[model samples]
Target chain A: MAETIEMDDRTIAIGKNHKLFDVERIRADFPILHQRIHGKPLAYLDNAATSQKPKVVIDAISHYYQAQNANIHRGVYYLSEVATQAYEQARECVRSFLNAASTEEIIFTRGATEGINLVAHSYGRRFIQQGDEVIITTMDHHSNIVPWQILCEEKGAQLRVVPIDDHGELMMDEYASLLSAKTKLVAFGHISNSLGTINPIEKIIQMAHQVGAVVVVDGAQAAPHTPIDVQALDVDFYAFSGHKVFGPTGIGALYGKEKWLDAMPPYQGGGDMIKSVTLEKTIYNDLPYKFEAGTPHISGGIAMAKALDYVGQIGYPQIEAYENDLLNCATEALQKVDGLRIVGTAQHKASVVSFVLESVHPHDVGTILDREGIAIRTGHHCTQPVMDRFHIPATSRASFAFYNTKEEIDRLVEALHKVVRMFQ
Target chain B: MDTDLRDLYQEIILDHNKNPKNFHKLDPASHSAEGYNPLCGDKINVYLQVEDGKIVDIGFEGSGCAISKASASVMTTIVKNKTVEEVKALFEKFKGLVTGKVEPDMLELGKLAVFAGVRDYPSRAKCATLSWHTVMAALNSKEEQAIVSTE
Candidate 1:
């Protein structure tokens, strides 16, 4: 039976999944995971930082550059026309992938960082006045926090923070208390990059909407692991990076509600973002194009669309189910390691497992793991505030994907035991 | 079991890391500076009591990995009673050792030579010398914080 999502204003129909999602077949699609490192097989568990690309996504990008490399929008010949079609098609793909209301609501950005910066500047400049309150959670990445800090500094607005509990879960009571009429903006992450906390965004959006505050959700960490419907969430703005979702780097999308996009000014002024230019006054382009300036990352966009298709083909339910199994496998395996204190054990967590070993530093653990060809992310993870809240230097983070296996988790545990032995 | 691991974490280094030498703050110190490695959030507060050009007593307080904590501990033991210029020279030699720039005689380094293995692991080089940089920051009267990043 087909699935249908009921939105605030409309309902969208979804097709049924047909293919048997085999993990072995999926592993073979990524060419990078087949290699060896330090005389051992590579187990790339750094998916939180970025994901390995499938061959089809790679081929699609290469095919674009080899055959259809031309500037888009302003076209004269066949190649440009083809390029423009592909670019626009990518926009449509991203719109549907995010389940946005329309393609006109999607704007190409440099990544999630640029997306947040766009709203912080554009929306903050016009709507957020002096003494207005902007609330963000303690678990947000630096990308989500810094832009708002800059915006608040510029606008004389007070930036408030929602704290998190020991389990890395946001204090929802505190969040509810933080809401007020003076709260002009509320920026938070759907999934914490450091803690892997899957925030209650549907409720967060509803609460922010009650306060008349525009909500900007950092979907960078969530976009890869979970299926998102912007209309269903009714979020004012959503931002995510393509690279994290198995797409090429330097390309991302910012999905804004049409009303907010209409009111907000253009982020950057350059070619392709204007309707017409004059010596005195220039007319801006319509929604989406108004924010996208300069010659965009054409190949990145096309390949990102392919990546989205790759995920859509397999379906998010399968991906989430597989990843949850892997996460559980990793969590259970890590518990056997002596004196291993997991940093983020949120009740509602994603595939990321961050922990600190007793008397062993994360950096040292990371180095030792690298020797065993286990690539884990070890550092503050750009959520330095989260590190401070935990009273830690850093934590070793092993984020998983659907293609990752339980065997890899075994290798990680074995390597960590070696780390403990070495320190001893 | 590997030679690299052996060299990186010698018995002396491990001893210092577990039971660090001069791991307390030198109260009534003449000079002090804070060191931070933003990469790992490692922090060290270097303290020294200098009389004339020679440092009489030195100590540090902070949390870091075995390499950094051990290096800071080892540094306090070696740099005490050494002149500022001598300490600066030692810093240059130690920096060179970790970076794989100059392979000085291990005996010449004495207790500091244990860090020579850090040369191979480029990522851990900063951990080996974050405290040394802080001492420089304190001795030279440079910036307020000696931020070392192994980027």
Candidate 2:
């Protein structure tokens, strides 16, 4: 069936299940993929850093600003009502995407970083006591690690870490042993950004619950690859970024269980987050609004819904299957190069592949590849502890999306041979 | 390969990076400073022995890309036996060479002119200059300070 979305002034038609997964068709949807860089066709392998926006997502943003620009929630004018409906509808889209129990459980945030920071401030202040422990993993991004460290430092609590093995997979046995009555919280990433390892977060969540500890999942990387069901995992809190999921930057969502949110103090104070305010006392608003304050990124939120719709149309099953093929091809091709060592060979992985050559530094490789118009991330990937654990200075990571292809992976392998030749 | 890439990674740079000159710790160093770029994961220490207001000896040891290692290696050879004022002047010229601020032929850049290609890649200019900044910090400080970070 064909569906038409009417946005006040513009009507768009989307045909459902009319075609199978075609990389060419998908690539055509993103305007940025068509341009040439340095006289070579661009092979963008830096999807983990930030994904390029599709034309529809970009158009949605322009449409919002053009026809639906107004202050939401407080205005009674026609434009205001339209803008407010769009903003609130975006929240529902997020709620359905994550399979959260209620719309009240989803709170708009700046990104995954702010989501973690919100829980760290509000819940940590309410429940975490002196001498309590907050457990994190060695493979967590700095966003997940730093907020907990800050919270522990302020609360006089100790921060515990679950170490990873050489494969970049968390030692689940170690994580189980680290849990005890003193453990107040556990925060970890659903997928490792640098290594591409998909963590066993379901088991991790269940273990944390047994100890009366709350779990906050950093799902920034996982959202783009796999499906998330907050209700199925029974995860206490889940956070993801919009840009990582092909949406606009500066917009994300945090899904928290209603019980924990009702007990936690308000994360921020402003106009929308309060029901009534006086010089002496202020009563905060209900569930999600209590966490979201002030005028939000209205256009960004609306466009993010369109982005989610785009992904939903493709369906995660087909996307995952296509990306897995790409990841496999890239892994095999990269391994063929002499003296090339692929980092993070976990049992389960997303589409990211990180590698290092024997003599060439990753920065040098990045520069060489850029001349060929192939963009890849070269550095610690914001997981410094992962670098330390592996005893590596840095790695060159090529993360893929559904829009990527076998031809691009071949190009990467060809360029890598050139890198090896230059170094030799 | 493009000329810019070849120019950036010249034969001289490859040689220096492979077997860097004065790539060692200066035993009993009178002044020393460490330079690190957290983003690039480059960490290096510049060691100096000064006498009579002159840098009598210079050496460095660390891990980095080809440009940074070569820059540190060549910097040791040029600044050795020069007066502190001369080395500071050389630092200014080298910074200008990499940052595209000063024309290469306008000043006596010597072998440092090889880094002129770095101006095209803005991100890499830092790798070419981190060691220079660290050496300058070591020379200017009376007492050893914390590691200089090239953010």
Candidate 3:
């Protein structure tokens, strides 16, 4: 049954079975959660930094290295064929995860950063020219901003920014004004890591298409929280990191539309990304292989696919409803604290809570919370422009995962009260 | 755990953070340098006026956490009117204390000894040492503006 919670002046209605999501069962899947840090139960609230790996995903890595360890695509031996099949199957798994039209659309990257750099190098070099404009939002992460900046510098193009309102929402009118015939690319984050604001990416993609500008989305934060469909969004490029989705680091996926992937030049040349190499001429390989140069993170790819499977089993609907309830509870509880102010109050937000105390610095608050074994991220969160817009040096952010419980948040709130008292 | 935290955020350290000494720019300073901790966005600027071999005036201006601000504030008060050689020695001693290389002694550091708790937080040691590095840069800079970063 749905229940209405009177949280001070606001009333929040939690959906039925939000509490019945069987979170304890999900928590048990992650082995690292049951531990002590600084003489207290560990409260891992830094999920946005990186999520804890489930046992299935961890086992996948060991299994890959233990049994199927061989070179892919080039080897003809029995072990080599097995390894090659596993790797290609992992690609198919990723293609299904993002609902891409084909596996050729997915490119294995070191992470989201490399994925962006690949686009900037290949697409920008061929398309962008002098006096062209590349648009980005103020809420873009450094990864999204810097690559476009470097590309604009190389092409002598102008880099335009879409400003955000006081509520941390993008000013759509300003974005409309920034778009024109000369706009070559529009790159932005699917969700703000610092503010937890979920941008209207479907509308953004539609708007960019009007100006003939390709849209590139940094989905590092969005992939773990919500379901994604490349075909549905019609996004030219979508990139996400594996480590943030309860998988291994040094591995990620970039989904590009087939036409765009075919049109762009090869990012790097190496052993696997070649049809045949002669002394005078060299031809590049097929769609995904052209972008993946050198020996890729083999085990990481298989394990990342396993991670996606794990999230798929729990389902996004359940994850979203339960996490939204947690976000509301934490926001209301934090608001009740004296002299505390939340940084972002977007109309539609994710599970991240960024806040600052009136008298205490965020770094100080982080240290105090650490003593209580509550790990929250403290700083600009690699979004310095967001910090500058808010006129604060830093903020203490508590980002939740599916495994986090309401009791852990209570522990965080209690520790924050102690921090306030200590500073006072 | 409370006692451990108290050691780091002692009453004297808290006082210095609240009402920092020489927490302003020196209008006609002879030298100045800025220090930045990129990891946490803590920034500090140290200004100095040197006459002969001694420091005639010292001051600082910045915004940071309690540890960084108090370290800069106390540094200005202690370094003024001291010879350049003595200031350099104190910087060495202070670095040693924060890095756990030298034992914190009441006789050696006097009021500055409270910072001995920094050794436990390796990440915070840079916060306490940022201002000192800036001051040294200010002293050594000939004409160009000096800047340092604790990455």
Candidate 4:
């Protein structure tokens, strides 16, 4: 049964005290957070850009390199078998993480950027036709926007964008109206990186399905914060990066339904993605192997599994509850600053808080905050179009994670007040 | 309560940031160019008024960090009433000072030499140099379009 939530300040305040995990213990697991920056304790609030790895994840990568370093899937040797087993186990772990229907549906790529490019080049080239419409949202990251723009340009198709309101929420009504007979595909982000607005992807998928359009979800931001069930959402394609989830970089997963995977052409051609090859013609391998052409990042894949296991052991439900509390604390504390305006204040948001001061540039704020040992992301954040939509050059963002605390937010607020006083 | 990098954030940089110089649009400028640092999203537009090979007036206006804005403020002060050749020589001296290729003589660079400490931060070197690069670009190039970013 769905849990009914009370929508009042007191109930929300009560919810802050009920986290399932121990925040102090969780913070201890991350070694980087304990360091001193510029003589002050490092208050890392750049979780949206990338998360610091825990000891478990660090040891897992080191252990693999030291003990089991071999190419996967191609050797009769003992070490090769061990490596292959670990790689496939990682795939299964990711399958469970996303609640995917099968391991065959998951194809590992470099990251979400590469995953989107693969779909745009392979699936879009094969299925989408000229004069067709591909709908995306204003809140999309550059990775989601540029690849589709390239595909649409190549196929002579038109790209349509669904606008968002001042609150940084997608206009679902506008999105629904854009769906028509000519709409071939609909791609959007599950959670916006810049705004932290969680899109109603299930409803979006159902609406696109009514118009016979395929839906692709950019889950780079959502995967770190929420429980993702690809099957329940019924999204045709979903992509996320490992680095953002406390895993090693250069590894990510793309989940496409078996039917769609079977229908799409191979993304790249090489030894692994083929069943047999002659000079004249090449027969592509089945499902995922067809997409994963080259020898993959073996160490990265195994390390990602360890990262997923780390998150699993902590319990995502617990992590989410704790992070929401941090978000509330940060929002309230930051609001108290004079001349400060929170940029994205959607009703439903993740752990990110993007804001701007009345007269201060974000770069200036970032530089001053750095002296206080407060690490936050500042600038356009690779979402220039979103910046354009907001009519600001950039914003200073402080994104939270489960390991963060209210005390750290207190430090941030204190530092921000000093910065404002110094500037104004 | 204190950080080692506090020396980099000296009072002069903050004062210059609060009261920036040459911070107005110069219409009918003989030369105007914009520069951007994509990494930090710091932008600057340098405008020059040249008459008879001497810079009569120099103005700049844009948004960026304290370092970039302060550097621009100091740049406008030094480049005024100077010839093109003198400005080019000053650019080289300033570049060398900020990159740590040479120890800055504060007597020569005036308030601009305060930014010599920024060379320690490799990532922020571009932020410090953004406006100077725009000045150089506007002085050298014939193009009327704004240069987006130095980075």
Please write out the lDDT profile of model 4 over residues A169-224, one tens digit for every residue: 98988988899999999999999898888888889999999999999999999888
lDDT of 2 by residue, A205-291 (tens): 999999999999999999999999999999999999999999999999999999999999999889899999999999999878998
Clash statistics: count for each candidate: 0, 0, 0, 2
Better of 2 and 4 by TM-score: 2
lDDT tens digits by residue: candidate 4, B1-151: 2343555667887778889888997888999898988887777888898899999998888888888888888788888999999988888888888788887777988767788778777667877888888988888878775585674
**Candidate 2 total steric clashes:** 0
Give stretches of model 3 more than 4 Å off: A1-19, B104-106
Docking class for candidate 2? medium
Q: Could you give candidate 3's per-residue lDDT for residues A252-338 as a string of tens digits?
A: 999998899899999988888889999999999998898888888999999999999999998888889878988999999999887
Top candidate by lDDT:
2
Ranking by lDDT: 2, 3, 1, 4
For each candidate, the DockQ is 0.80, 0.80, 0.74, 0.57
Please report, as a residue range, the 10-residue window in candidate 3 chain A with the lowest summed lDDT: A5-14
Please tell me the interface RMSD, in Å, for model 4: 2.3
Q: How does residue A288 of candidate 1 score in lDDT?
A: 89
Clashing pairs in 1: none
Question: Between which residue pairs do clashes occur in model 2?
Answer: none
User: Which residue runs of candidate 4 sit more than 4 Å off their true CA positions?
Assistant: A1-19, B1-6, B146-148
Name the runs in model 1 displaced over 4 angstroms.
A1-19, B142-151
Where is the poorest 10-residue window by lDDT in model 4 chain B? B1-10
lDDT of 4 at B98: 77
